[model samples]
Target: MPLEIVMSVSFARAGLILGLGLTVASGACAPLRSHQGYIIDADLVNSVQPGVDNRQSVAQVLGRPTIASQFGAEDWYYVARDSRNLNFQKPKPKEQITLKISFDPSGTVKSVTRTGVEQIAKVDTFGKTTPTLGKKRGFFEDLFGNIGTVGAAGAGGPGGGGGGGRDTP
Candidate 1:
């Protein structure tokens, strides 16, 4: 009976140690945050015809715009943006962008518009300067340089090594 108790205790300790090791290793390999922004309702914009779509009807079709003109009140902005921290790493976009469609006083579509300033990248910039390290690197350099390193692997890692046993050679 005493021997059985000792063996069980030993097994318990081993399991605890293994669990702790796994927890720490997982914590260390958290992914880098990734941000993705794009126009979600582009189809809604294309469907509207300048002459056919009126203010009330357009509102019914596209739901509502994100921003409205405070002064004019005739303009409507339908905007959708998605910014994700795939791992929650660094500072990302403070602003988002979408298409702006305007209506004239007669209630037909007046102008279809977008400003370059507000549109976020569908994919985050890769070749530009990295904010965390404050250094810029070319696209290929960042790709190959970080590949297969111990730090980069996480759940659904880019290389397909950590989460699943299967990986592309």
Candidate 2:
């Protein structure tokens, strides 16, 4: 082969190698983003009232709660939440709120109890959002884009071309 032709071939090979390396490296370091929210404390809700607290008066004071009793209208529940996140990644929950109030047969306040008003560090898996700009690329996009067409196309084998088939000589 001519010396110039050989040198050009070597440069092209180097470029292909560099491109493949970069593609793989980028895949390994994909930027991560997430968001999460939760209610940090239920006591803050005490700004209203509890325990034998006046039901009608409390409702007027705290406004309507987020939840109510499933079987009857005698019980009411108030809920609070906090959320945080970065971007593509899922959000994390920082706090939660659960208020339970029971009323007597005459619709008077009987008892009030609360639960799940504790700080937590649980991942908010449901906060996933699909990106709008581009279709989500997977491992293949980076792998194929970086590898040279010749090498990548033939990676499957002699007869496989771009697929994973046995390359029979």
Top of the candidates by lDDT = 1
lDDT of 1 by residue, 1-169 (tens): 6999999999999999999999988876765443344344667677888878898888787776667787864787766444433345654554455667878888798878766435555565866745575567788988787666654656455564565455469
Q: What is the lDDT of residue 16 in candidate 1?
A: 100
C-alpha RMSD of candidate 1? 23.2
TM-score of each candidate structure, all chains considered together: 0.47, 0.40
Task: Give candidate 1 regions above 4 Å deviation.
Answer: 1-13, 20-39, 86-91, 94-96, 114-169
RMSD of each: 23.2, 22.2
Those runs of model 2 whose alpha carbons end farther than 4 Å from true positions after fitting are: 1-52, 117-169
lDDT of 1 at 9: 97
lDDT accuracy of residue 1 in candidate 2:
92
List model 2 lDDT by residue over 46-68, tens digit each: 65444446777767656676767
Candidate 1 clashing pairs, residues 3+ apart or interchain: 65-77, 65-78, 66-77
* Full-model lDDT for every candidate: 0.68, 0.64
